[model samples]
Target chain A: MSTTEPDNVALNGPVVGRYRVIPLIEKGATAGMRPAVASKDVQEALALPGTLVADWQDKAIKRLGQLVKQRRGLRVFLDNCTKCGACTDKCHYFLGTRDPKNMPVARQDLIRSVYRRYFTLAGRLFPWLVGARTLNKALLQDWYTYFHQCSQCRRCTVFCPKGIDTSEVTMAGREILASIGLGQQYSQEIITKVKSIGNNLGMKPRALADVLENLEEDILDDTGVPVRLPLDDSRADVLLVTPSADFFAEPHVDGLIGYAKVLHQAGVRWTFSSQASEAANFALFTGQHDHMRDIALRIRNAAVDLAVSRIVIGECGHAWRVAYSYLDALVGPLDFLDPAHSRVEHICEVTHQLLTQGRITLDPQRNAGKVITYHDSCNVARGASMGQRAGGQFRIPRELLAASVPRVVEMSADTTKQKTFCCGGGGGLLTDDMMAVRIKGALPRAQALQSVVDSDEVTHLVAICAICKTQLSSVLPHYGLQHVQVTSLHHLVGDALVL
Target chain B: MLGYLLTAAFVWAVAGSAYRLIVWARTPSTLPMPLTPAPTSRVGVVGRLLLELLTFRALARADRTTWLASLAFHYGLLLILIMHLRFVWSQLPPSLVPFIGLSGWATLMLIIGLSVLLIRRIVIDRLRYISSPSDYLHIILLLTLAASGTAMKRLWPVDLYGVSQFLQGALRFSWQPLPESLVLVVHLSLVLLLLFVFPISKLLHGIGIVFSPTLNQRDAVSAQTRVLSGSSHSKTRE
Candidate 1:
């Protein structure tokens, strides 16, 4: 079984035969993967009120026991792993960091060991024999270091015969850590921002309106079309819930433009809610259900206040998963919305429906200058479904892209669809301090992408998720593929949309 | 004494397994997390479990070597277990008699499968890194059970009629005299230990598979309506 190798020799690290052994470090000193301690403000925002330095070990153990019973995935996954090691080489972090702790089962053992010590008879009687350990400051620190290293992508689950999802384990670990106030600053800070300002980036209503208005002007200047980016229009037919990054970031902004053009051509009345402008839910990354629910309810309120018949989510992977799989449970029935369409639909599904119905027209020639390939976002591919089919998540975006682009290519089979690799900055590890880990974690996807680029001269790599656009664009230059552009699926659609 | 000890071990195994099952059942599955490409119907889920049990589907997709070894070990164990039914039955079923001879091959396959797994765990760097003392102990325990059982059959033959009479008498609530063979005693003791440990060890994976939400739940997302508990009273204005 030959695996695709990254084009950049340095990305391969120190290779012995077929395996890469990046020396395991006790801590993340070299990769700078350590997150700052959650500030008191962030902790309070998450409703996890406690002192960071307090002796909360007993409390944490009790909380974990409660969580294991509450979350079935956690309980079953912890008990199910046979340490078969089928998932040992499956994690991108393990491949990149060469850290044994990064291996999915080992990463899981950090929590499972403690679960055994507290919850299982064998663990209580013979801890060392079963590899169980007591909960202590050292174990907690290991939990913080290793859990954050995971992207919670669920790749390991697909390969695990027992169907053990390390993402569930990672989420449970994060939840337990947060209960003791040992939260990751990146995700916790974002949750705080989303709570106070209705978005991860903390952009206020005024700034959001200005950004949208400016984008409308840019569309007119570039395409000679008077496209409108409406905001908070109560009578609109669709409520556009998008990530705040789309209003500010480079390639993400272009994807936003693409969505606008598609809706404009389809003649659908859509508006962005400044109050609930953000779609990225950082709370899910931390496994904070209350925080996630509070964040999702804002969108429900936006949809209700606007009297929008339908709600359409923007290009964000994990956010889409929360919207598709969790929103209904968190703040739904959503019974008042249009029954003709899904209560919450992905932008790709909306565009695909429009193209299929001939509600919108696209000129493939407009996107003929570049050969494009789609990178299936981890959460969307493995976590959520689109349309009415099982794999609509994988097919819907590609269908829309193929409709708008003259040529489309696929990366290696091993790295696409359910086996898709993370862009390495997901699950709230996108902070600048974690760049080394991010770059290393992204090697597999980069190598797979690099293979296609070398063979097919694929000029553009498009993704539906905002984080993928940001992460890949940043990491591409590091692998000497600086010229290969990373764009959004909607970016190409917007480029080809005909008025 | 052996009969009483064996009965006690069976009771412990059954009670422990039932306790584990109750705990698993009590755990709340707050979310539906079926891995996508999963079946959306109850019938489909059954089919998925069947495929998983018969083929070790996911492991096969992951690594062929481990899958082959595991398939041999599990199926070999199953056949060996079925062959044990002959001792409990006074009249062996005609259909099953033809396959009695295959028990020798089954034992060999079990040992070979276990050796492959043990070797991989010891030799493979990645596997060795994740393995604990208990992991190695599991394989060794099974190997000893297989070796002792096989030796009693071929190397040091036991009193089959005496063993059958004792087993039948126990089932009938009539305690008969035990078979006076050292090899038989060792084999029976090993079997008793395995049963006691089954529910407490990683062997619980046998039961865990049936309850795993990712593998067993139906992916009927649209069909099921989730009733949101609390109303959204506080609204953030745009």
Candidate 2:
């Protein structure tokens, strides 16, 4: 909110009216950083000039240069391409949007040009010779727009012979752009809320407590069962958490209802804490590593404080990837969190196991007559090694979908395992502001669904990721798709619960 | 002049490099994976062909300025290849002789342009930051090949007729020994080096991009564009 004048392209500049913006710290160059004054007043702030500046100067610059090298290196992926187009017919978004640029090769070239100009000999010496473009403000905007269009989905890599990862490039682009202070406002706003209120929804402990109290009342009205949605209860056996969207939104709330019903039926000793309740981390989308780490820290600390046995994540896709892939490395060896006491399971996986064991009877007809198809969230299916594993762990979602709706059909060119298209929302491009790309990016998936709708008369779109659900719901209508309601895999379980 | 043994080796090396470049340029032929089938029909085929020729990438608009320089380098490189080809025939087709001579002169200008460009990469700090070891090696390779090949063809034409006859005999598989020459040796060595380096380095992308999922995608899916600028997308505060 500070309206201060911005500073130089390099080195320390003026802080936005209040906080002092330190010189862009160069990695390996040990630039000294003075502690920010606790007081908000700018003039009273202290400065640690010479030594601090010198420390980080060379190192930070070197790191930036290294990033440029990686960008330049990606061009090999660009130039060596055979244009055989083997993977073209495979992308779900392309089927959905009909845009040529959505294809993986075209998508990567945008980022590759910047890499060439700054990193390659030809691009550097004869900048006009090798098609290398300089990275300026306008170019930065194009990258942000185009990179966001990719959901960090690994579908292209699965089809690619060399396994070139567009997601990695998108992440790199985000970080490089962020270092230059060119982050999007929507993601930035959410990060601000996470930093200030401890949750992406700006839900502090007290606000979350109120929401839980209301949720308990709603559960009583729906099932006539007095279920207590516990908050901040210490020493609970299982710590269950979900995206804030579920608590306030439709059908997702029903999905939450299903979760409560399962816990009660099984007599599982699980608790939901208001203090660290959010499972959705938008920071992952914006490439805000520290923000993501902070969110993870709160979750870990809360679980440790309560002495929970296992942490079960609700039906949020990328959050689970961040949890499974990064949390252990980023916030753990939580010697404090006993390994035996801490395990993360996707809700669908847990529910499917419960059903397979015959602990819960499923009513097949509850979801009857709905020709249903499933959209694999990129994080769980593509980025993570969950569905791709050779044995049973990967097949859990497919089996559950089939069992729930007897009419489950596979989406076209759908990568069941490591290959999956991003929902155009994975990197946090899910909001209405990114609707143009979401509309285009979702085309491949929608087109696949349309085939089922026309040929098989499918009616429902089942998804495991909340972002995918949100994105598909908005995109389907644009294509004249009907009655294809998007809901979590578990909500279907709650419907078929044979109580 | 070196012995006939060196000439034979030099000719063999140049042939190998030409084989590699052609393979690198036309990677669709050796594909180990499934092919997306090049777009069919007059419009699609013509569009596809043009894209192939120009390496047309919409996202590459940033490199619009480099088009002329790249055209010069590639055109020069292509011309030099044709001149070498003319040597393989005993009697140059009367019509092609003038074209070959023009291409020989063009190669000289291209080498000078490329050298200037390579030096720029080394001197510019921003450009230097991202450059890799192979990038420098590639520039050196091309320039060296051009310079050496130009010298052999225009400056020193020692036993030019005998060299042409030797090349024709090799092409015919008669196994004739090549005429001894230093410029030809250096040019052939550089060309061979470029070949061995192709598969391992970024040069590999020349074959890889065609199979790039983005370009080859058969689906008509459009990715949604972002409404917000990246500069405003700060999700974390340091």
All candidates' lDDT scores?
0.83, 0.56
Tell me the deviation in Å of residue B29 in model 1. Answer: 0.3
- Consecutive 10-residue window with the lowest summed lDDT within model 1 chain A: A1-10
Each prediction's total of clashing residue pairs, residues at least 3 apart in sequence or on different chains, is 0, 89
* Model 2: per-residue Cα lDDT over A1-499, one tens digit each: 1111211111122112211111221221211111111121211111112112233324323434555333332333544533323344444444433344455555565666665565445456756544567655455445555565567766666555443556656766665544444445555556666656666677778877787789889878876887777777664566787877777776577678777776666555567877567787767765555667887887887777777656778888877777755676567665543343333556665666567666667786888877777776767664343322232224777787677766787766443444345665567676655565566455545556667777888878777777777777776676567467877777777776665
Model 2: CA > 4 A from native:
A1-63, A66-103, A121-129, A334-342, A387-394, A414-419, B1-201, B204-238
Using all chains and alpha carbons, the TM-scores for the candidates as numbered come to 0.94, 0.62
Model 1: residue A314 alpha-carbon error in angstroms: 0.9
Residue pairs of candidate 1 with colliding backbone atoms? none
Q: After superposition, how far is residue A126 of candidate 1 from its true place, in Å?
A: 1.0
Query: What proportion of the real contacts between chains A and B does each prediction keep?
Result: 0.60, 0.05
Question: What is the CAPRI rating of model 2's predicted complex?
Answer: incorrect
Mark the 10 consecutive residues where model 1 chain B has the least summed lDDT: B226-235
lDDT of each residue in A1-499, candidate 1, tens digit only: 0112233225434222222232343333323346666778878766786456476788789988988979988898998899988888778888766778888999999999999999999999999989999998778878888888899999888889999999888888888888887887788898889888999898999988898889899999999998889999865778999998999898999999998998888777789998898999988888888888999999999998888778889999998989888888899789877656545888888888888878888888998878988999999988888877768888888888888899899998878999988899999888876777788788788878878888899999999898899999988787777878999888889988888
lDDT of 1 by residue, B1-238 (tens): 8777776777788899999888888898876788876787899999998888789998998888999999889988988988888878998889888768899888888888999999999988778888889999999999999998988887998889899887776656676788888888888888888987888889989778888988987767644443211112212343
Q: In candidate 1, residue A293 scores what lDDT? A: 93
